[model samples]
Target: MEEIIDQNEHVGIVADDLTSAADGAGAFLTYGYQPLVRRQRQASVGAPVVAVDTGSRLMEEADAMRATGQAIASLAGCRHLYKTIDSTLRGHIRAEIAAAFKASGRPRLVIAPAFPTAGRTTVDGIQLLHGVPVAQTAYGHDPVHPARASLIADLIAPDLGRMATVPVSATDSDIGKHIAGASIIVVDAHSQILLNRRIAEITKHGPALWVGSPGMAEALAAVVGQSPDRQTFTPPNAPRHILVLVGSANHLSHAQYEALAATGASVADRAEGIAKTASVACIHAPRARTADPSKVLCALVDEADIALSRQWYDAIVATGGETMSALMERLSIHTFTLVKELEPGFPLGCARLSNGRPILLAMKAGGFGSVMTLCNATNAILQMGRKST
Candidate 1:
């Protein structure tokens, strides 16, 4: 596909969580857009592409809608708008999407929540995770916001109006026919090629609100074209101390934490011991299935805050959105300047505390990374620090 350059086009991305917001913005980094992820809806935007985390997924349905609507409303002037949803169909998908649609005032809403790289796909309007219906996957049993169904149409609220489903094999004209009268259209995309084709065809229909995960962000970035001046990354000075915080209850996250622990990283028994005993220390929530998520997150944040008070770490790695969000809030950090993505869903960036101290941060969604992801991230952080010195 040929690149379409539009110097005046600015993109706005709205996500239900922080990790999603960072990864969504990180998608535009390849095209030379310096992306910024703001924790608040009204934060200043210094980059062409800005992603905002509404922190709405943890809210009740009504509050989620209000938060989502306010965030979209704040981004009213952006020429292009995208909403990021969980690829596995978790959270208040229906309510938040409805709010974004109402706020954007875009004539058509196109929904394609496929991330082929992660084995999430949509086929015949059914959302699948690794060839199994999402409702049958681990997400269905999520401690919070479990998915109730795999059918895309079934997941969306009926009040949103009739939705047309476009198959992967559908021609451009077939997509056009579906877009003409449908208020919402769900496209079936099982691969990168199919997803790209669907996005390319949809963009031709003029301005419409696009919805999906990071895969959709990548496609939109392509449509927006490469920037005239690509930004170069300058690795920050190596961190002398590193902290890994794991607050996700996902089995995958637990496994990743275990893998990192096996590498001999000290597991912190007390906040006071973190700064004195080890250069690399890990703090994780209990792995019991019956652990209360809210209490667990609060404990992690309290422990991290105490560690920071004793000594500020140069680099911190956090798993799960709730964990990262809670930590950032505790530090009074409202914005994250995305430098690069260490991996597809793992974004590395810098954030300033209320006292104006900058710290390197690497964040990942609980369910997204491999078992070795945390270990690899730690190694990468150490290497970056070493190269700079």
Candidate 2:
């Protein structure tokens, strides 16, 4: 995002994870609204569009509900409040939406979790992935929030309490006419035109509460009359090395890690006790389930020697939210200077160390990007560094 430091801003977003937050902010970034991705709530309220990552995707149901509810309640003052969910239907989607609905105090909650460009669509309230039910996709094996069914209604049946439900249809003359007086309306949007049309019509009367992925963010930004700017990018100076950290148990991330290993990078199983001499290194977290995720992550960070990482590594690419948070904690980094999107689901930027030096940092959602996404991201950071200074 470019210019979001003024008063009376338009959009505010609550994201469940870091990558989702970055992707949402990147949407505003493309449209010239300087977007800020904050790890903590209420950290970027001054900007025109603030995307906050609650980092609650892996929490227990009760904990996730409480955290999501608090996040939504805290952001009630924004002109347009948007809840960004993972397009793959991971995390506590049902509970989080219900929480946002209750906290926003709005009469209606319009849900459209489709990102057609990413092959995620909602037809008749069932979430389909690449024309197949999401339950049949690789996400069906997700460790944390395994999606066993593709029906949106079935997926969210637990938390959708007593609210009037409406399923939208594309053939309808105006989708907005059906948005009112409903506790939750699942809008069926398979394309940008439909999304923009429905969103514009829904909010035609006044402010609205929106829920979806980054696709919705882009559509909403466009609806607010913000045309994207044609901007050129400048990369940073070259670094000593590149480090890739894999933090998710998702099969997609595991495959990506294997792809990284195949590239001849020095790959290590545990992060805590690894010594590195190679220009490129990959630290792969465990694939098996752990009873205590936070403790395990912290131990890994401690063994990986994060304090010395900034000195030896020129660029850092992390694949999941918990991994990103652990790295930040070990390095004592609080804020990131978000540059722009390196790929569809990855945001490339820089974070400053206590020594005042900047290092390239790129984050990707666990299930997003291809097997080569990590390698490409690392190369992009290296290229950017070469062009800087």
Candidate 3:
């Protein structure tokens, strides 16, 4: 509380005892996800809760932070203690809430479920997890948590909507090998940097590449999608798709052309012209392989196929968990901000968003994974890698 006050920001002190102190401030006074100031003012009264736990162990760590917060909130008091949603950090929050519940032996623990703050988590179930006194569900996803809606309306003002596809060559193809008759047509305005990266990669493909202003269809002409959804899909499809090849003794034999040929997609027959015009919203489309999951898979395959391919790829193979982690570690940062811990290094692998908690990834594959299907792993790499470029 002091730190928050010192920082000169909204100080939200949770606890039945300190309700008054946080009066003008945001208060979980009612004890739930959104027992905001307005709702607190409108409501006549309510009970209290003692403890709460978020769902799932999640990599076994989400509960840590929650438990910690609960511990702190327990110290506050006024009449009620709002237990936040269940989260991996639930244990920590519970410890704090437990303290308050133990003191009051009946503080109202409310269910406040909503998308967690960018840096926070939500523990949907509060009363059951913690033996607190009373429970009040304020908000939820599908059911529309009333307490939650109240605050969001009071704060944000909600608006929502919407996908798109970039056609390669506009021409139709008669050949059976080609997925589409046209060339690659990428979304021009796509994440500019990523777009530029893909453009640069296509350029590297040399004469095999045919320019189409910018988009997937054009890029695919020069390359092939490695994932199931890249080109021909069953039914549902994604607009942005990329393809990469890493066969032939894992690049030792370096049969680049053969690798490109491995995919049966053919050139547009009687190909005339592809529309160069592009639209916005390309920002989210596939761009570049900043992490290179394919490289990781290639290394893994070559490492195992030594007798089959020998020294051809002895130097550039990575057929192991460490290699895969190294590949996705970069992009995974967006998913789990605290992901520097996952950077590939000796001794300790890296830290990643396991189930939900932040746990350091260790090498020497510890637990036995049942379906360690290499195909699924390959497809996973292809899916993530194609998005890179």
Over 240-282, each residue of candidate 3 has an lDDT whose tens digit, in order, gives 2211222212222223223222432111101111111211000
Kindly list the per-residue Cα lDDT of model 1 for residues 191-263, writing each as its tens digit. Answer: 9778888898788887878899878988888888887778866655567788889887778988887887788
Clashing pairs in 1: 238-385
* lDDT for predicted candidate 2 compared with the true structure: 0.71
Displacement of the residue 287 alpha carbon in candidate 3, Å = 9.1
TM-score for each model = 0.92, 0.82, 0.17
Per-residue lDDT value at 98 in model 2: 75
Number of residue pairs clashing in candidate 1, backbone atoms closer than 3 angstroms, sequence gap of 3 or more or interchain: 1
Q: For each candidate in the order shown, give its overall lDDT on alpha carbons.
A: 0.82, 0.71, 0.23
The 10 consecutive residues of candidate 2 with the worst lDDT sum are: 1-10
Q: lDDT at 197 for candidate 1?
A: 80
Candidate structures ordered by lDDT, highest first: 1, 2, 3
Judged by lDDT relative to the true structure, which candidate is superior, 2 or 3?
Answer: 2
How many residue pairs clash (N, CA or C atoms closer than 3 angstroms) in each of the candidate models, in the order given?
Answer: 1, 11, 74
Could you tell me how far off, in angstroms, the CA of residue 241 lies in candidate 3 after the best superposition? 32
Residues 1-389 of candidate 2 have per-residue lDDT tens digits of 12222335567788887778888877766665556666653344476677777778867878887877777666677778899887778888887877777777666676777888888887777778888888888888865677766766654444544333335454444454564455566777677677777677677646557888877877787776663444445544566578888877678988887887787677777644344666667877788758876776776566456525434787788887778877876777766756677786687766777888877778887777888888777766666666665
Worst 10 residues of 1 by lDDT: 1-10
Residue 223 C-alpha lDDT in model 2: 75
